[model samples]
Target: MVNVNCNILQAVDKNLMIADKIFRSRLMVGTGKYETVQIAKQSIHASGASIVTAAIRRLQINHPFEEKSLFKYLDWNSLWLLPNTAGCTTVEEAVRAASLGRELCKKIGQSNNNFIKLEIIPDYKYLLPDPIGTLKAAEYLINKQYTVLPYIYPDPVLAKQLEELGCSTVMPLGSPIGSGQGLKHLDSIRVIIENAKVPVIVDAGIGTASDAVQAMELGASAVLTNSAIANAQQPHIMASSIQLGVQSGRLAYLAGRMNELTQAQSSSPIIGISS
Candidate 1:
C-alpha cells in the first residue's frame, strides 16, 4: 500500500484528539435529538467524531425490561462519551453531577481519567452559564482529579480563573445554545484563545460548517456542537461538512495568513521590464 501523507490524514492523526488521554474524531458532537438512536449514530460516524457529549442525569436511566440500552446504539469503543451537567444551575448541582459522571464512567468500564463537560446554567430562558457557580464547581472538581471542561461565556478573565483552578480546558459559548448565531462573540472568543494556556473550545451556537471553520481559524483548539448538526435536514452530510471545515480552518491557522493592503497589485507596466 502506498503511504498517503495528506493534510486530512495528518489532521486525523494529530489534531483528532486532546490532552486528556482520549482519542477523538476532532469534531465533538452531542447525543441529542434525532428521529432515532440509529440516526444519531449514523450522523456521528459521518461527522467523523470520536468525542461525543451526553448529559449525565437521573432521567436517562434504563427502565427495567428495556430491550436496548443507549450504549447499544453506537460504537462505544470508537467514541469518548463526555458526560455534562446540562441542567445544573448552581455550584453544588454541578459538583454533584461531575461526581456522578465519574462514577458512571467507572461502572461502564471507562478509565479513571475522568473528563466532565461542566455546564451551570441559571437562566432557564437564555440558558447562559452562571459564571460564579461554574467557577466554584470547576475548582472543586479539578481538585478532586477530574478533568473539567466547563461551558461558559466568552470571558477571558473567567477563563484565566478556570485555568488557575486546574481546569483541563475552557469551553466558551459562541452565542446561545441552539441559537445558530455563528460566533457572535468573535472578539471575546479571540481574546480567550490568545490568552489561554490550555485548549479553548468554542462550544454551542455554531450554526454551520463555516462557523466551525471560522472558530478554528480564530485559534480555537476545537469546536463542540449539537443542534447544528443533529437537527440538520441531512445530519450525516452536515457532519461530514463540519469535519472538513474544522480541518480546513485549523490548517489555515497553522499555515499563517497574508497581510492586507489598500493599494492594488501591479500586474505589468508599473515601472520597467517591458518586452
Candidate 2:
C-alpha cells in the first residue's frame, strides 16, 4: 500500500489569498455570538485563523473607554480584522458602513487594512443579502480603494459580475446567516467556485465541520463560519474542529480525487490472477 503524505502535496494549493494578503488557515472564524468577550477571544485563538471577521455595526470598535471594546481584548498584531456590514439593508447604508470600517481600521493602527465584508441584508426573515444593493455598494467601495468582500447568494452570474467589479472575494452563503442550516445551495455554490476568478469563501449557515469540509472540497478558497462555532456547545473545541476540517478539505482537493463509477468494481486485479 502506498502511503499518502499531505504536506508534500501542499505546494500546489499554497495559501488562501484575498487581495494582497495570504492566510495559512482557510477557516476564517467570525467574532460574534459568543457568551463573553473572553470566550470569543479564546475561540478565535483556538481556531488558528489569521483573519477574523466582525460585524462593525454590531460591535463597538471606537469606544476604547468602554470595558467591552473589541479592540481592547483581541490582539491586532497577530490577527487581521475584517469589518463586516451585517446590519446594512441598503446600498447607501452598506457604502457608509464600509467607509466607517476603513476609518476604524486606520484608527486602530491597521492603516493599510482596507478590508470590508459588504452585506446588504434587507431580508429580515432569513437575513438574506440583496444582490442588487450588494453590487452597488461593492462598486462604490471598490472605487474608494477598499478591498470589498461582498456576501452574496449562490449565483454564478452575480459572482462573476462582482469579480469583474474588482471585489477581493465573493462570499456566498451556504444558507441563511446564523441559521446553521449548512450549504442548502450546494450546486449553485459549486458553479460559483468553478467560475470565480477571485476567492469564493462560503460565509454562513455552516452547522458542522463536515459542512465546512463540503464547501472546501468543492474548491472554495475558504469559509467564514460563526454560528457553527460560536453557537456550538463547546465553541473553542468547535473552532478547532473547523480548522481541521478546512485543512483536511483543502488537502483533499489538492490531492485530486478519483473518478466515480456507476457500478461496483473489484479491488484486486482479475486478469493477472493465477488459475
Candidate 3:
C-alpha cells in the first residue's frame, strides 16, 4: 500500500491536488458569507489552509472604487485561490463560469493554472450537484488544459470517470450543502477514496471539528468547510478547531485504527471457576 505523508501526519498525505502541483494543506475553506473580508481572512489564516475557494462572478462595476473582488483582502502568499463555478446549472454555463474565473484570475495577476471548483447545481433549495453536467464540464475543461476539481455526490464511479478525464481531484459532499449534518455517505466516500487515482476532498456538510476528523480518518485527501466555521460565534476559534481536526484526523489515520469487535470480552479473571 502507498503510505501517506505530510507535515501534520506521517502516513497520511495532506497534499492538495492543484493543476500540476501538490499543495501541503488538507483544510480547504470557502470565501463566502463572512461578516467582513477581514474576518474571512482571519478565519482562513487560523484554519492553516493553503487553498481557499472563490466564486466566479461577472464583472459588474457599480462604482469605480467598489471592490467586487474577493481576493482583495486574502493573503495570496499563504493561500492559493481555487475559483469555483458555484451557481452554474449546466455544462455550458459551468464552462463559461470557469473561463470567466480563469480570466479574472489573470486580470488580478493570479496563476492561470489555478484549480477550478466545478459546482453545477441545478436545484436552488437542495444545492445538489448535477453530476452528469459536472462530468461534461470536467471533460471540456480538462481538455482545455484547466485544472478541474469537480464537486459531486459520493459516487465512486463518478470519481473514476473524472480521474480518467484528467481531473486533478474530485470533491464529494459529506452531506447536503450548508446542512452541517456531517458524513452520511461515509461508506461511499471511503470507496471513492480507495479507488481514486487523484485526490479526494470532502466538500460540504461538515458541522464540527470531529466531522472533519472523521473524513480525514477515512483516507480522504482533504476537506472543504465554510458554514460550520464561518457561522460560529467565534469564527477565528472555530477555524483553529477545524485546522486541529484535520491534523488530528490525518495523524489518527497514520497511526492506524483498531479493528471493530463483534463481541465483548471478559476482563475479569475466571481462573478458579474454570479450574
Candidate 4:
C-alpha cells in the first residue's frame, strides 16, 4: 500500500489552477510602488511569481507597451499579465478600466488574456474596498468573459456571494491597502477559506514573509502583495524571502500542523525513577 504522507506530499506539489490556467508559483507580484522600473523588474524575477499585475492607468501613462514600458522588462509569454483597475472608484469606471486593460493586454501580445484585478474603492482616507461596487463590477466583468479577481473585505458572507457570482477568485483583504497590518482580519479570513468554493487569495496588508506564511498556512490559495516587496529596503531579497516563506507555509499545511493543547507535553518522556 502507498504511504499516506508521501501521497499527500505529492498531491500538495501540484500546480495552482485559476480560471483554467495553471501556475507553478502561488505568489503574485505587482508592478507598483517600486523606486525604479529596474528594481521592480528584479523583484518580480526574485519573487518567482508567475502572475504579475499592473495598474491599467499606470500602464497607459507610462508608454503603454512601448520599449520603455514595464511590460518590456519581463517575458510576457512566461508571466501572466493581470490588469488592475486600481484608481477606479465606481462600477462604471472599473468596468471601463477593465476593458482598457484588455486592450493593453492585447497590445502586449497576450491577446487571449482576459484577467482583471477588480478594485472599487470609494473611500480615500482608509482606501477600503466598496463591496457593493466590487460585486457590481465583478458581475459585469465575469459576464464579459474576463477572469475577475476581486479585492474585498474578509467577510465570509461577501466571500460566498462573490463565489456564487462566478468569480475566478475572491481576494479578501488582510488589512487596508498598503497598510502592512498583516492579516488584521485573520479569523474572518479563515472562515472564508473554510467556506470558499473558489480560491481564497489574501491580498494586500502583507508586510513581510511572515505575513505570506501565515496566509498560506491558513489555506489561502495564494497571496498577492506589492507594497511588502516593492517598499522593502532590499526589494529583491525581500521578494525571495516571501517566496521561501510561502513554500514553507504550503509545506507545513500539507504536512498537517500539530493540534494545539491546553497543557504542555514533554518532547521526550522520562522513565519513572524510584522516589
Clashes of each: 1, 0, 1, 0
Per-model TM-score versus the true fold = 0.90, 0.94, 0.88, 0.93
lDDT string for model 2 (144-189, tens) is 9999999999899999999999999999999988888889998999
TM-score of 4: 0.93
Candidate 2 Cα outliers beyond 4 Å, as residue runs = 1-12, 271-275
| Residue 203 lDDT (model 4) | 98
lDDT of candidates 1 onward, in order: 0.81, 0.86, 0.82, 0.88
Which parts of model 4 are misplaced by more than 4 Å? 1-11, 61-63, 272-275
* Superposition error at 48 for model 4 (Å): 0.4
lDDT of 1: 0.81
Superposed model 3: Cα runs more than 4 Å off: 1-14, 17-19, 58-69, 265-275
Q: Tell me the deviation in Å of residue 116 in model 4.
A: 0.7
For every candidate, C-alpha RMSD to the true structure in Å: 3.1, 3.0, 4.5, 4.1
Mark the 10 consecutive residues where model 4 has the least summed lDDT.
Answer: 1-10
Which tens-of-lDDT digit does each residue in 1-275 have in candidate 4? 22233344446678778989999888999999888879989999988899999888676533575776677778988899999999888999999899998988888788999999999988989998999999888898898999999999888999899999999999999998898889999899999999988888899999999999999999998999999999899999999889887877778877789999999898875778556
Q: List the residue pairs that clash in candidate 4.
A: none
Candidate of highest lDDT: 4
- Model 3 poorest 10 in a row by lDDT: 57-66
Name the better of 2 and 4 by lDDT.
4
- 1 against 3, candidate with superior lDDT: 3
